[model samples]
Target: MLKEVYGNECSSRTQVYKWFKLFKEERETTEEDPHPGPPSTSKKEENIEEISKLIREDRRLSIRGLAEKTGIDKECVRQILHESFNMRKVCAEMMPKLLTPEQKESRMKICVDIPNNIDIS
Candidate 1:
């Protein structure tokens, strides 16, 4: 019946069945329920700066140690270390993942130079 009305614009049969199941189970709307947990705040700029300062002052701190010192969760500390700072572990110490801005620019310059050097004709 929905396909008759909406043609190719209708939801797939699997999706329609899924919605039907939700409606049968007394679901109020298609909106997802809020996940149960404390709101995340450990990745804020202040936290990142603080972590950077801490790491600069002491290079040997582990993720657990950082979390304990700063009161951020261990996972969040790990994320800030890996994602924000672009760092990874080496011999139990955090080391940079090694892509400096200058190096990246050099690579991009080579890419641009390649097209300019090539001749399609």
Candidate 2:
């Protein structure tokens, strides 16, 4: 309507008023997207549950086995065990059985059996 009013005179009041109005309208019309922010900071729960399931199903599984099962790297599995689950390797007890009195004496005689012929006596 303002362009229709301005007939190439270059002094039209309507053109100045409409330009300012359009500029203000454009400023109000444009808006930044509301969803802008950092990416997700949490891991998927499914991955955590899968890791837990794999560990529970085989407590003694090697890191490679766990990695195969969970689709993660072997190093990653070890990290999850150490950091997330607080797991450690359990050592087997290897102490010998209690010795009988006769067995003890026999062992002691064996220790003295060395070099009886070379004794000072």
Candidate 3:
């Protein structure tokens, strides 16, 4: 039996029958025929731009919030944030993976200020 021999690698019995029928009909190849469908529209340039605008407006917005606001899927939103914008979440806010010079300087100032401002108990 295919179940015993092939385990999960084999197709369903119905699909095997369908393929057999196709082969009997003189189908040249075992590969599937092309079936046209509507184009994918979710991850377009427009969507990328919209996401960029939303992030600039509020860096603290989560992927779920972005998806709801843009009517995009959560995974797609996260992909856009990571791949398109090169961003990641830090302290519940989206930030670039690489810091800008100004941002580095600002962080340095904050780090220096923190130790100076702390008082011994």
Which candidate number would show the highest TM-score if scored against the true structure?
Answer: 3
What TM-score against the true fold does each predicted structure earn?
0.51, 0.37, 0.60
State candidate 3's TM-score: 0.60
- Model 2 lDDT per residue over 1-121, tens place: 6346433523346545655665666643224422222222222366567777766776667767767876666676666666666665554211124567987898788878876756695
| For model 1, the run of ten residues with the poorest summed lDDT | 30-39
**1 or 3, which is superior by TM-score?**
3
Error of model 1, residue 45, in angstroms: 1.0
- Which of the two candidates, 1 or 2, achieves a greater lDDT against the reference? 1
- When summed lDDT is taken over every stretch of 10 residues in candidate 3, the lowest stretch is 30-39
Q: For model 3, how many clashes?
A: 0
lDDT of 1: 0.81
Which pairs clash inside model 2?
A: none
Quote the positional error of residue 64 for candidate 3 in Å.
0.8
**lDDT tens digits, residues 1-121, model 1?**
9579646755677666666676678665544633222235678899999999999988899999999999888999999999999999878778788868997898799999998999899
Highest lDDT against the true fold, candidate: 3
> Any runs in candidate 3 off by more than 4 Å, and if so which?
1-39, 114-121
> Which lDDT tens digits does candidate 3 get at residues 15-68?
666657766786654337431222345678999999999999999999999999
